[model samples]
Target: MRRIGLCISLLVTVFVMSACESEDEAQTFADRDQETVKHTTVKPMSNKNKQDFQTLPNDMQLAIVFSSMIRVSEAFDYGIGNPEYFVRSSMTEGEADIAKENLESIQFENKQLKKQNNEAVALLQKTHNQEMSHNEMQQLKENRTAFFEVTESMIKLISQVTPKNAKKTRQQLDQLKKQYTQYSAESVKIMNSIVKKQGADKASFERHLETMLQKQPGQPMLSELY
Candidate 1:
């Protein structure tokens, strides 16, 4: 009977040890998982104060504006092409309804911008070793104007319809709007002079601009929000 009691005690002791081990293992795994999550989590984009584009060099300012225009144009194309998808993914029904109300107008704006983008691309491609004609330069000015005007209109409409709960999106839109204001005014005067050169000056500028365009990287600042 003493041997039997000893055996039972041993078994009880082993059982308690096993339970304790299992709990310790579970806790170790839980801690590791918490550490992994802490390391892997993605933080939200911060709104850092950026230097005004107007303060940048003329070439740099134009590069940014041109790159932003291209990125935003691509975004507009995606939204226009997949209206249902965009609405479903990014907006509530109420917001979708508001977007739909001005759908035609926005579509028209997109169409105009696309036309100008095509023109600019073609002009740049053929002007590799030559100067742009006065007419071509004029067209570029018009295209730049259209880009800012259309983008402003689009931003305002999106801002108006964006849900208040979309804090990140609203912040992004505001930042973009602020950028638009910076690049659209005095920067225009600089861009005009840059594009309005003649003879050798025009050719050099065109080649430089074309090379920049050809190697232009994607602008996530404008693309992510759209």
Candidate 2:
């Protein structure tokens, strides 16, 4: 009887310890998430318009590419910057498959937001050639809100999520941002020069952009969200 009682006490103690450990881990994750807010803080992307994609820091380039891929996927479009294309072309076969799975997993967890994004895409397509009605505009706004809900997760994956190594990760991201800004100034000059010589025809510009993306194969071409 004494042995049985001892065993019961041991089990209770073990269970309590396990529960405490889980709580501690949750707190740690929460702290990490709080720190992640800083990882996301950035100068507006309007700043990117001035810089050529070539001169941006690697991480900044990837960040832009990541955002672009999300837009492409949400819009039900496919191209060099689309999520599947980026994952498949950027990683090895095995890693690419895993990344694809991860994206699906994240999308599953954020299903409602993903659904809203899909609905937004439908509305956007419907209004592509026509003026947006008030309801359409309202839907677009809701879509934007939903899109942002999952943005933190997207950044987490692209920027690296482990908080233990945050200092190193942050330093790298900062350097990339500095370089991205530097290229921004140069890009505006190039764009202005291009516009002056040749009017920005949609067809020609898209052709050029598409050719550029095709040539870059694995590189991300981030959207300006403009």
Best by TM-score: 1
Segments of candidate 2 deviating more than 4 angstroms: 1-158, 199-226
RMSD of 2: 23.3
Cα lDDT tens digits, model 2, 28-107, are 11111112111211122355564654454333332343233233232221110122222322344555444344334334
Q: For candidate 1, lDDT tens digit of each residue in 197-224?
A: 4233444434433444344223132111
Best by lDDT: 1
After superposition, which runs of candidate 1 have C-alpha atoms over 4 Å from their true positions?
A: 1-96, 108-112, 124-167, 199-226
Per-model root-mean-square deviation over C-alphas: 25.6, 23.3
The lDDT values for all models are 0.37, 0.31
Q: How far in Å is the alpha carbon of 145 misplaced in model 1?
A: 13
Q: List the residue pairs that clash in candidate 1.
A: none
TM-score of each: 0.30, 0.22
